[model samples]
Target: MRRLALAAALALSLSPLTAGAASAQTARATASRGLTPAEVGTWITGLGGRVGPVQTENGLTFFTVTNAGLTWAVFFYGCEAGVCGEVQFSAVVPGAGATLDKVNAWNRDNRYLKAFHTAAETPTATVQYDVVVLSGEGVAQLADPLAVWLQLLPKFAGEMGYVAP
Candidate 1:
């Protein structure tokens, strides 16, 4: 019985799941350096997003990425003279079946993201992250959020009864 238990423990420790966990830890440790607006744009483009021209207004840098049939704006906050302190990802929800309840439910269930409805009957979902201008989590921190957003885009479309382009 002890030998069987020992063998089971060894198999579990050598599993691919354990390797994936280790890899995730390593990625987190290495992605401490944050990104600039331009760098963020580059990363989005690299992720197969259709990126629009970048614009700077006031202290924010803004750009749009069209992916999974949704066009979303990526805003870099506190950007002045080309540096940023935070980033926000937002998408305008289609007005057909989008409701305040859906937004509220999303906000209540989600931990790192939020949804809101505007007076103009537009629903928007956003995810924001604060980062140190120079030495914070860089593209690595953004990769998962972007990926998750992409996955949710289809679900949001379905919930709002909007057809994906």
Candidate 2:
């Protein structure tokens, strides 16, 4: 919980993330913060953190996670076209493995999304997408972000149940 704040604070400190900058930067370290390994897992499931796939009216990529009677979410914000996307994954609440499967499921069915996994050391999952920068989500007529989200999801599922720094 507190660690997440510290981690986010530290991560945020690395760069000036005002509305100006677009695209996610390196995953800068932040001491030991956020949810615990197990809790983080649950949070991924939709309990206390942002987990499940979500498309806002404003067109932002927002998802949720659940844990211990809590609901959390992650907001993948800021970007457009093939340009810079202010990559920001924020856990709404610090819970447990609450939205992992949901995220995995969404990734499996999505089309535009692409899940990137490294066989080496700590296998990580990332999505390659093109979004509409203005709204910060998906467009009603355009299916770019939705498609990308679907594409880069299954790969992440293969590495499901992941938890670490």
Best by the lDDT measure: 1
Q: By TM-score, how accurate is candidate 2? A: 0.25
How close is every model to the real structure, measured as TM-score? 0.65, 0.25
Give one digit per residue, the lDDT tens place, for model 1 in 1-165. Answer: 999999999998889888998999899656544467788899889978999989877756789888867788888875544656667777676665677777677667766556666545465433343333445656677767677667766676566556765
Q: What lDDT does the true structure give each of the candidates?
A: 0.70, 0.40
Stretch of 10 with least lDDT, candidate 2: 28-37
> What TM-score does structure 1 among the candidates reach?
0.65
Write the residue-wise lDDT of candidate 2 on 66-146 in tens digits: 433433334544333322233333322112322445455646776555343433344334445433333233223123433
> Any runs in candidate 2 off by more than 4 Å, and if so which?
1-62, 65-123, 128-130, 134-138, 159-165
